[model samples]
Target: MNDKTQDIAIVGGGLAGASLALLLSHHLPQLKITLIESFPLFNSDNEKSLPSYDDRSSALSLGSCRILQTLTIWSQLKPYLTAIEKVHVSDRGHPAGTLLDYRELDDISDEEALGYVVENRHLGQVLLSALAQQSNIDTISPATVAEVTPQADEAQLVIRQGDKQQRLAANLIVIADGAHSSLREKLGIAVEKSDYGQVAVIANITSSGYHDGVAYERFTDSGPMALLPLGDFNDEHRSALVWTVDSDREADVVAMSDEAFLQTIQQRFGNRLGFFTRVGKRHIYPLALYKAKEQIRRHIVLMGNAAHAMHPVAGQGFNLALRDCSALVDTLCDATVRGQSPGELDVLNHYLSRQDLDQEKTIGTSHLLTLLFSTAETLPAFARNTGLFGLNFLPGIKAWFARQAMGVAGNRSQIAQPASSTAAEKRIK
Candidate 1:
């Protein structure tokens, strides 16, 4: 093989791209992988240099935790992770509410909890550290793919790093840049976007009362809000807040004094976690659902936010992306065993066929939840409260929904399942 030729070239070194690289390296060590990113991946002096590795936190479904455990980095992440033992969901001024407890799940144990919450920086640190130890994977930082051209058997990339440029070819190219991927557009892959006319204000918050591993999802007249439990900092009870409000009021919310913001949030969320004591820096971004027109084509595959970006109301965005990664890796591993090329269109199509249903279900559920909880109209409000009330009394339905939230409800990749399970085989056939 030429020095410039690689088995796979992954664009974007954020969470998605980095995770995919690690998985591929772990499973297919013989395949040479190249990771290209536009930002400086690491800086010991300043950890928050990368935008994706900032102060925000991610909710990792139980399935995601299982998948990461396979990568051998879960031990490093455990100290920084906060388990979500229970999820409390309610509507403002409504008597109806529902609690999803990990104990209710048949296959899960208390130690496993329902899911976990980890700061993005800590997750990034762990993933990147793991990447550094992968002998088969090469990373190029502060670099961008200027262009991508698909040939008959492979995809070629033009990488720009400072004043210099280099051309590389790979049998397969994975795009995991982000929701607003410039490379996806450069390849003429269009994205369909649905604006929710709302924005999410995110920050880390400290409360007087302990969360006790409870995650709160509160729906108010303005929009839906989530207070995900966070590991205590400096002996203070803490949580990550994602407050969705109308786009029109975003400016006012961002400009409010810390005390005023806390007061307003206390009003909207009530005394669930007790009085809000402190809040960290605030970040705001508009909420929307974006899906690429195409996810797979010959040697090119779109992964992560590049494929689908959903509202955070249900916290399914990253979990869905992680599932896609696992399925793709399983497909590629099978292809390798059969002496098939990684970039073969048939292999790529098979991978998509396996994950399409999962993507559809997750995206649909998230969209529906966003719309249902964010609306204050009489009909939707009534239906929403009634549904919550029904869930409290419906054991089977509640369990199913809990599974969905935990990311184990639908078909999963073989690698994400137990060694003896036949569900993956059934899905493959």
Candidate 2:
């Protein structure tokens, strides 16, 4: 490969794109990288121009934390990391309620938390900060896409960064934009979208009681609500809330205030997490499941939310996206080692084949669980709660569920690296 031609184009400056740039740079320092963002540049402190991640936060699995730590970016956002030592789940008003302590799982260690919660801003900033350390990465913003015409060997991208536009060619183009990615649609890519008729009302609340690193998820007839702890932010006990409400309830949630919202919050949320004291700003997003028809198309590939955007009930979007990041990076890095064109069909499909099982299992399971729980009828509720309560009596079954949640139940060989930091331990397949 010519040094000048060994460049990859990343179309998105979100967490997924920035992480991909850092990983590629870490593995192949000689390759050139061009990262583009449609949003204009601005300081993080400019509230007037800032976009709100709202009360929204992401829970990163241990596997995800491992990836970020390997890139040396975890320390940048450590202050914001809320380790989830245990997850308490229950069905309000039902006979059976379930709370899962990580200690029950023999596979998971006692010291390691189940996951870590970090706001999106923290993730983006940390990723961008890590990108600055890479000499080969060229980050650009306010970029307009002129064209994305796929060629036999490479996909040509004409990106207008500012006044001057450059005709850049990349061996591979990775798309990490959200569910409604215009670029993916423009490229004639097909996608499967399912509307759940649900809205996720999110907010951050200051709780009077300490969470003690416990993340709570309760499912009521309305929908699934998650109370994720925020690690002692500003000397206050905080937990991010994501409540999935039906279309009819969305209007009321949007109009609620700190005082009025607390009333409803207390109704479902028992005294377990202490009093609901104060609430920060709130935001809402419609829930939907989207999966791209194909993982790879010629020289173009979609990762992150662009590939599959699931309902937040499972908190698997970013985790699944990170798996994509690792798989793609490994594939390209291994191709480089073998002196083969990374964008070749054989090479790209090899990566896709390794990821297909995991991709289908997570997305399908997400949709399936959503359908099963959202049932409003009493009979369905009885059956589901029976299962939840039954697991409490049987420690064996609880361990199985715990392992599944930890991403160790299935054959995760595609995303699992050997227990070593040496580059040679990384798997090509």
Candidate 3:
């Protein structure tokens, strides 16, 4: 294609793109990786959209923890992470609730947490830092991909950086630029989208007492509200809150005063952690289910939000993307070690095929959770409450839910291996 052709060129330096580069570089040291981001890597002196570096919070399932461990950045991330030892799920005003405890999972120790919650900005910083230290990985920032042309052997990209425009070529191109990826459109990939008619409002909150590392998922008439434990703040326990509300009410919710908002949250979430005394800057995003019709096309592959974006009900969006990252790494590294072309249609297709089942299960689960918890309909509400009771009533169901919350259930890939169990054991020691 060109004198400077790359082995793999990734578009978007967010979580998926950055992690993919690091994972592949670590496993296949012989291959060269180039990562391109349309926005600034982080908040700079100059104002720019730093999507990867934001105040948002993400829950990392234990399965996702293993993938990070495989990439070798988990150790650096552990200090700042707050463990999710248990997930307390309930419907507002309903006595019936489900507790997906880590102890429910077989071989899972009581000390081991089901997941960890970290600010997206912190995790992104860790991944970006790790990427920077990789000798085989090249990072590009504040650049835009004006176009992508896929040829028989390689894909070409027209990138615009500042005032200069250049043509770059690669054996394969990965698109991970989030839900509204322009490169995906340039490649003529269609997305199947369903709007949930809701918006997610996120903020940091503090309670009167300790959270004990328990995450709360409370379903109200408005929607599902999640308060993930985040250690503490100024002698008060802190948590990250994600509340889904009807699109029509989003504006009013966002406009509320902090004290009034806290009162409303207390009313909806009950006195679980005592009172939500303080609230921080709030952010909101419209909720929807968006899936790429085709995950891979010839010399290109889609990843992260570009591949599939679902509701944040289960906090599986980034977790699923990390799993997709692991599957791609496994497939490509195996093929490369065996002397196969990573850009081959068969190679890309294999990655897509393996991810399909996981994506299906995750997307379906999130959609069903959103529907069941958000609806005020009597029948669906009754069934949801019944399902919550089933989690505790049936051992098999409790174990299954625990596995899902731990992020170890669906697929068995090299990345999703029980390596984290070893880490958990070490933690216990």
In order, candidate lDDTs are 0.88, 0.76, 0.84
Candidate number that wins on lDDT, 1 or 3: 1
lDDT of 2 by residue, 1-429 (tens): 112343688888666777778878876777888887776433454342113232369988766766666666666778878898889888888767787765555444443567789987776666766776678988767676666778998988777766777777788888876688778888888999999999988888898899988899888778888999887767889998988889888888888877999878888778888899898888889999999897687778888888889988888887878877887888887888899766677888988997888888888878877886786688778877888888889877776666556554454443344235432122110
Give candidate 3 misplaced runs (Cα > 4 Å): 1-3, 42-49, 109-111, 420-429
Give candidate 2's whole-model lDDT: 0.76
Query: By lDDT, who's the top model here?
Result: 1
Task: Give the local distance difference test score of model 3.
Answer: 0.84
Clashing pairs in 1: none
**How good is model 2 by TM-score?**
0.91
Candidate 2, backbone clash total: 0
> TM per model?
0.96, 0.91, 0.95
Q: Is candidate 2 or candidate 3 better by TM-score?
A: 3
Error of 1 at 80 (Å): 0.7
